[model samples]
Target: MTLPAVPPISFQDIATELRLLPGEGLSFSWDNVKRLLGMSRLHPGPISLSDFLGKTRPWWGLVPVRSNDIVGTTWYSWNQSDGGLAAAVDPYFGNMPITAIMSTVSASGSDSIINFQSDPGFRNNIKAQLLDDNYNVVREVVLTYNAQAGVQWRSATLGGGDTSTCLFIATGIFTINLIKL
Candidate 1:
């Protein structure tokens, strides 16, 4: 036997069924209201400001741009196709020649072997470092580049079979003023 046809429901029908009158703002529980509105899949409650700002993907390296923050001073996380983890930051600090420090740790939460490399052409005066558990310097390298020709950028990578935390800290006078994570 065939089932009887069901009538299509609309906003007015839902509101009426819930006894919600005009100008009578949401007297029913939020869940009930959502259910009546066919929005049951939505989150049950309001999300925190940090979550709204993309902090939920910390492991994925999503950084939320904020007001009153210095330009190009943030390091963002990146994931490589070969199952490696990486982080990068813009090294351009405008014309004043200010020293900017950018750092990031391994996304895996454990010590892992890693390497640091700066963008090929714009690397003068860039000090890249790896720190240990006590924050002591493990390995450090200074990247040099032609001052007038290339843009400033730095990156760090976590490699295979390695079991040491990766912390990258770079201090230098960068050329550009734009933020590129």
Candidate 2:
């Protein structure tokens, strides 16, 4: 079946509405969490499958440091609980439609791991996926990342054609629910 097209929205825009703390504490307001998940009211924390079906928010997101720059590779890895991940993509295509599933993982004094998984077929030759809280595919991109051994910022590629352009965010034991609807 063909899906309707809806433009992508930024997490910051959603975060601003939800009043989420920025790089500080981990307290998320109940009401904002509901809105972030696109729920009418807040359900139990760590939303369940029932909640997932009712929501429309992206399943995953990556917090942009500056307007154009995404955070960092280390942050994108599942090792850092506080770190984040944007959907992987090919740079050749300016924009590709997607629905994503995402999660963050970090233990005390440990690296963060941001896991993202999705099919490239849905978006038509897309490279990677972005996720929402319920592990849903929210965004797709045509970009890839190349991380040197000790680099801070990752060099993003335009497409998934180059193996050297790809980087994997280590999948640590970050708890996330990614369900393709």
lDDT of all predictions: 0.31, 0.33
Compared with the true structure, the alpha-carbon lDDT of candidate 1 equals 0.31
lDDT of 2 by residue, 1-181 (tens): 1111343434444444333468533333454455445443435566533332324333333432211113422223332223445343322222232222222222222111222233233322224444445434344333322133111212233223332322223333232222233
Candidate 1, which segments miss by more than 4 Å at Cα?
Answer: 1-83, 89-124, 147-181
Residue-pair clashes per prediction, in order, are 5, 42
Q: Give the top-scoring candidate (lDDT).
A: 2
lDDT string for model 1 (1-181, tens) is 1111244434444444444568666423354453323233243544221222211111011122111213433332222222222223222322222222233333333221212333323233544444332223355544333334343333333444232322333232221111212
TM-score of 2: 0.20
